[model samples]
Structure formats: structure tokens, C-alpha cells
Target: MSPANPVAGDERRRLVEDVIQRRILSTELRPGQRVNESRLAEELVVSRTPVREALLRLEGQGWVLFDHGRGFVVTPLSTDEIRETYPIVAQLEQLALTSTGPALRGLAPVLSEINGEFGASTDPARSHDLDARFHRTLASRCGNGRLIALLDRHWQALHRYERFYMTHPDDHRRSVRQHDAIVAAIASGDVASAADQLVDNIIGPMHVLLERLR
Candidate 1:
């Protein structure tokens, strides 16, 4: 198998990480799905070593679980896990929001562009991308590399729930409006309002998802 792009060892690891992360988050790899190492290596055109390494990383991150006889299965999150995670996520988002200063002002236009695309998007896949981008951009500005990395990991772990919300018609519509509120609050430098709006935006859809799962 040929590498699509030539990259060094660390870069190749990141590429593998990205591939697995995206597949899991997009639900291409559903919960409890067994990860076929050989098949994945063949499809991704990478050696088994990197694929194994990637799977190990994902397992450590709680996105995958080791089954006694089944090898690695995508981790399934319960409603309780979702509920337990939201408040922690909210607190992290609030920290990021409060830490924002002038550096974040540059993100305003990018956020607006993403919001515009999200509003006009009729494709579910495209909408999910936009949604991910919006939150990721917000978190990336927190000025703490470790915090940002942790959030990225959490985001990937929560992707299944997030996608469920994004693909639901009613939830998607509500998200657009809520995203606007968040953007407006941030643009106005109302940190507290932005934090509250972020929590609401996260928890509201999560409520819908939890109800559906129940």
C-alpha cells in the first residue's frame, strides 16, 4: 500500500489518528463495531504497525474498548455518560471563554463564515463538519495547548452523540439559532453570557439526544 502523502513518523501517526478518529466520530465505525486491524490497514493503505498504534491511542483515550474475545470495539456511551460529561465540558468551555482576550477577535469572521455555511447547508454531512469546526475553533483559542488537546480528545469521543444531534432536523434548526447567540455573545465580549450560551447550546441538544436514546 502506498502512503497518500509522504510524512515523517510523528506525522504518519497523526494521520492514522485522524483517520480512526474521523471514522469513529462520523459513525462509519459504530459503537461495538469490531475494529479489523488487517482490514483497516489494507483500506487505509498503512502498515499494521501504525494501525495498531492508532488503535492503542484511541483505546487509551476511551474511544475504543478491549473486548475479551472481540479485540477492540468502538466504545458505546450510555445516556448517563453523556449527562455526566456535559457539565465537565461546560466548565472547560467556560474556561476557554473567560480566557479569551484580543486574540479571539480574529476568530469572529471565521465563525460567521462557518455559521453562514451551517445555516445554508442542506446536507447532513456538511452540517456536521460545520458544527465541529465551530466548536473546535472556539476551543482552539483558549491559549492552553494542553486544554485544547484534551478538548479535542473529548470532542472525538463525543462525536457520536454530537452527530445524532446534528442530523436531527429539529435539533439542527435549533442549533443554528443557538450558535448565533453564542457568536453574538462572544463578539460583544460578554464572557459570562458566552459561557452560559455555550452551556445551553451543548446541554439542550444533549437533552434531546438522551431522550431519543432512552
Candidate 2:
């Protein structure tokens, strides 16, 4: 495979990265699965160079790991890793909510509408995307540029776990309920309470997965 246009190298790399990321998170490319650059180039209709560039970036993000002799493989995912990440993200999200204060009053209704759409959506991937959007919307109001950037980085890692949870019927129902509580707490300008709800919404599922792992 060769490049469509030399000038579009960066764009091709980015496109390949996003598709590969999605495939990994969706479990289409399972953990530890070896990546074939020539196959990817053929499948994605691009040159091997962009796939190489994309894998380099993904390796940096911990989405894939490269072996000097073996090229790249999807990184293993585990409940333990997600269990460690959820509480930290929850705390940061809470701090962001607190920083927003009364400015959050109007956001509840919008969140509620999104929550409704989330609950009704039967597509697991769409549901997962909506769930991330719900939190990212709140993160935007955190008013701390650096923290938002950090949270955004970790959010990508969290998506695979979130997608797992979205596949569980009981978990989806619980998510909707927790989202309601979170929205209500935020709408009332109770940052501490809203933060607590946020923590429960995230860490609760992680704990469930942990128990299952045990």
C-alpha cells in the first residue's frame, strides 16, 4: 500500500490511529493480538508509513506495546488497572464540578436529556460514547486547563472499561439512576454531594468488576 497523497501523511496517520484505537476498545482487536502493518495498510487503504507512525503514538498512550522483533500488539486490559483509575478520575471530576459552582445550574437539564438518550440507546458503542460525553461536558467547566487536559488523556484509557459496563443490562440501569442523582445534586449547587454521586457512579462499577475478577 502507498500513500494517497504525500501531503496527507499526518492526516492518514491520525485516521489510522483513531480506527485502531476504536478497534482495540471494541475488542475487535483483542488484547495481545499482534498487529500486521501490511494488513492494516491494505485494510485501511493507506501506506505502511502512517500505520507505523500511528502505532508509535499509540504505544506512547499505552494502547499498544511494541516489541523490537515483533512489531506491536494491543495492550492487555484488566479490572485492576481500571479499579485504580476510576477513583482518581472521580475525584478530579468532583473538583471540576466544585470549581464550576452555580454555573452548573443550567447544565442539569442538558445532562438529563443526554442521560435519557443514553438509557434508551440500544447500541452499546453509542451508549458508551454518550456516557463519556456526559462527563466530558462537566469536565469542560472545571476551569482548570491543565487538569482538563490530564483528565482527557485518561478518559481514553477508561473508555474500554466503560464499554464493558455498557454491555451489562443491570449496569446500564444503575448508570441511569446514578446519573439522575448526579444531575440533581449539581443542579442544587451541592458540589460535595454531586461529587459523592460522581464517585459512586464510577467506582461502583469498578468494584463490581473487581469482585467478578476475584
Q: Please, what are the lDDT tens digits per residue for candidate 1 over residues 27-122?
A: 898888998988987887878878878888888988788998998888886788788777777777778867877766677778888988999888
Q: What does the lDDT come to for candidate 2?
A: 0.85
The number of the candidate with the highest TM-score is: 2
For model 1, the superposed segments whose C-alpha errors exceed 4 Å read 1-17, 44-47, 102-106
The TM-scores of all predictions, comma-separated, are 0.81, 0.92
Worst 10 residues of 2 by lDDT: 205-214
Mind giving the per-residue lDDT tens digits that candidate 2 earns over 27-80? Answer: 899988988999999999998999999999999888999877777998877766
TM-score of 2: 0.92
